[model samples]
Target: MCPPGTMRNSTGATGIHQCEPCTGGHYCEGYGNTEPTGLCDPGYYCPANRSVSSPQPGDLKCPKGHYCLEGTVEPYPCDTGTYQPNEGRTDCIPCQAGFYCESALEPDPQPCPPYHYCPEATMYPIPCPNGTFTYDNETGLASEGECQPCISGAYCRGGYIMDACAGGYFCLSGSYEYTPAGDPPPANPDQDPCTPNTQCAGPCPAGHYCPVGIEDPIACPNHTIRNTTGASQLSDCRPCPAGSHCLQGDPVEYECPVGYYCEEGMPPEECPLYTYRNTPGAASEGDCYPCRAGYWCNDTGMVTFNQNPCPVGHYCERATPYPEPCTGGRMSTETGRRSNEDCPLCTPGYYCPNDTINVHGIPCRPTYECPEGASLEVVCRPGAYCEGVTGVPPDCPGGYYCPLGSSSYTRCFFPKYCPVEVKCLWNVRLDTWRCHILD
Candidate 1:
């Protein structure tokens, strides 16, 4: 009910108004259409009228600014969310920033809490949370830490810093491994984890190698040897040569027979004798096969087998002689040829009397030489080399046993068979005694 002059009755006739209807921007609203003061003030939100209570004289009240009292008549106090200008308000402010105000809707405004801000389109922004961050402050006026971004290899969940990546993974200076906010790797410097066949303190021993990035050394191929005590490189296993023996305790050094060289784990054998390997396993000591029968061990002293034999047509001439490379030539039989054995006698039919061994088909003294006095009357023994010419008198091959004053020959044990018609002219028939030709 309005007190007098303020819509005193239900009729709300012009007598109810306290002032002119249209003056001071007023419009009326009520069942008693006669209310003078049209509507409430611009900033005011009062309820419909006469019979309704009014605010304190010349004043309107509402919430928004801790004003309107509970159950204050609508015309007296403004609606829930809006405000009035007059003082002496009762109800606390309805709601503001981070909160909302609804009409007499089913759900009421959910007020905002600290750390929680209202996003542009949201009734209220959810808490930025512990791991998240944003830019806007001012208690959630706009976008906040939620927009903060993280780098590659990093896990930026909400807004706070994400877990870091380790070294070799995080990008470094725009590298693939780099990641902002990445975790660092454990520090252990052994080697470069990238390249191969390269080492820091040189490579490990033979039969052993260390891979890059590995903590320790690695094994090598079988049959290979290693330098265990920090060697720069490894060596290969080797076999012993001729005349040399190699075993566990043997030194790496090996030897060969004098004038020879050992080979294939066997005893020494001839070399290109005159041109042998003077030093065992010398870098250039590859020469090993003995010289051909023509060459000689220019190096003195027997390592005899290692030396070459006299060449055809040539002779060694003397014992204990320093050998020389043989020069080519021809030799004759009449005299004993030179030989390593001091001009040893030549084959029965081919004599070489000089200090040499080469004896060609030159005729031997078949007609005259005799064990006793070789005279016209004497002859070779049976079974002896009868190198005599037909009708010749007593010269015969060696080993013949001519009887005294005779020209026939005699046979001997272990001797070559005498040719037919080539009889030993030991006792007689010296002139007819002759060796048979294969013809």
Candidate 2:
């Protein structure tokens, strides 16, 4: 037998002819010459109906980007995500950069779309980063284009068209982050509270206050004053001053009117009853003065004009706005009394000294005389100095002495004596004559 891959031919002869080498694409590894032992080497093919009786046609080449096995009549396409570069390839290779091979049947890798990337051995395209865009027809082998920065306040996310940031949100150029709008830089040189990636900053809006960052706007506090709109810091708030009335979120100060008092950071309060504030801009309750004397102020918790005089028999003290009834035997026939002192004391001689009642027609003590309108009793008059007399005064006795207005008199104490002539008249001197007393 000839060595393997050699061919022997016979025409009904018992013995074999000399052996010959097999053709380039055919292999005859068996004994008798019938045909090449196998059709051809794997990855190569021969045509049908070729046998040992007639020499088989030379093996044909497989088509480009396709493969054929031994005895195969047709070629098969490469696998998905794979490709072949030359004709009659034994196996397929992974797709290259900037191209995509989606299926086995594809003859070659497809180019990546504009503004998109396709990695080596990839089957799909990937979009560019946000806030950036790439031009179509960018055919570099890098698998993607060099993305360009979008315009200010706009973003290009994964597409060719540029879009504007939504309200309260922003995007910066060459960035892929979208962020909410933030507060302005701190006004007082304080640290900024905003997080990174913020696109814009500004002051708090009017009618609201925002202290820091992108937090929600807060309504102004009660009694707020000045142009508080867009206030950025706590110092921007101006409390409503005294002598003024302010509502919540007020933009300007309002002066309190007469008869009203306004404290700081509060609404105006009306003056209390029996009080008056004749001037505007009263700052406190002390500014409301009490009503004048002799007038009856009856209202409460409000400014009043109803001033009535003190009623008869009633008097008002100094700075007193109400009338009080008189007591302690005090009386006044007058209409208006500024004070209780204006009530006169009871009259004299009528004995009206007690405080409870208005005494009238009452007389002084018996046997004791009193002057007109006198409050106390005095001794009886002179010609009436006798003792124990009720209705009228009695005259003094003939032997007694009485003084004017004296209650009693003294009696005269003396005895009578007569003169007697002495006998010695003769001899003597006229100067010596003496008188003698006779018992």
Candidate 3:
């Protein structure tokens, strides 16, 4: 019999003349046989003839980037869009999703690059279209649907880069070129052919502002106004001026109302307490004047001073916080006293203490005299008499004499008879009385 590794083609041939090694890509395991036992297994190659002395002599694993099949003599290269990263591969692997294998005999597939996408079994990455973009770091995209469209208020020409519209301009979606306000149609339409989907538009209109990449102009807020055109930022709107007020988006200011004052950019405020403003267009608190003398403005936002005059017996000064009573021996019978001087003194024959319009003065006492405007009563002098009904004192009577602080007269005796009834004289040095004889 031939050696285990050798094979015999003719049956029962002479000793070893017809015996030969197993054919390439085949194996012989048992003792002598007419033909090879079996072909090489898949994922393996048989490069040289096999011998029984050495087991499976030419059998080898397929190399990287190649594949092998049963009965194969040499390894085959992987086709395009397929790869073999490991040895002993029976079949090439199709490229994975989001990856590409561009050429044959590739060991591994490549991830899709930025701005490009790939599908399974793809040989090359596909680029994203214009007016769309992808981030530079974004890779391994799976399909064309993975690409992004350009955002509104911005533009993307190509290459996955987005740019904002310039100041004083606006942009819409899918914009490529900058646009401006178009001239009136039919007159000069060619000069400004305002195209849709343009990156930028008009310098903004009056009372409105437009920021970069904005789709439309924004109106000025309340308490602010604008007059000129081409406003690009919110700061272009000016505050309402003093002495005037502005509503939202107002181009002109309105005058301040009567009894109120308006400051810049502020709401109208009523005039302060104890103050008034009769006219419109008051700019600040200073424009609200204090109530004049002899007047009392008790509430806020008074428009007239004459409506509330100072009451009787009370004095009021300019800008007085409250009314003052007439006191200190002074009184007033009338209304609207401006100052202490305006309150008159008490009347004659009466002593006024804390007098008012309703209550005049107290009567004089019998033993005392009270002159005009007297705050207190005065005692009668020697040789004089006073009556409680009158405010003045009188001399002694013809038949009577008076002493100090006397309210009535005393009668003369027969021994001290009066010589002159009106003038009775006494001599202190002689200690005797001398008078003219009575008629």
- Candidates' lDDT values, in order? 0.36, 0.53, 0.71
Q: Please provide TM-scores, in order, for all candidate models, with all chains considered together.
A: 0.22, 0.32, 0.43
Per-residue lDDT for 292-363 in model 1, tens only?
333454553234433455545454443314432112122432222244333233333333333433444233
Better of 1 and 2 by lDDT: 2
| Candidate 1 Cα misplacement greater than 4 A, ranges | 1-36, 49-59, 65-123, 126-141, 144-146, 151-153, 161-439
Cα miss at 40, model 2 (Å)?
54
lDDT accuracy of residue 339 in candidate 2? 68
**Count of clashing pairs, candidate 3:** 3
Tell me model 1's lDDT, rounded to 2 decimals.
0.36
lDDT by residue for model 2 (255-331), tens: 88777888887777887766766677878888776766776656643454335566666676644656775454454
Q: Across residues 1-439, which tens digit of lDDT does each residue of candidate 3 receive?
A: 8877678887767777578887777776777767777887888777655463332343377788788888767789887678888888899988987999987567678898888888887888887665556788999988876777555456565536457755554443444434444321111125544444333234455676768776555778877887766667989988989998888755667888888999998888999988999998999999998999998888888888777888876888998888787665666777778997787876666676654432356777787777767777778765668767447778777777665567887777777754224434456898754545434
Displacement of the residue 303 alpha carbon in candidate 3, Å: 2.3
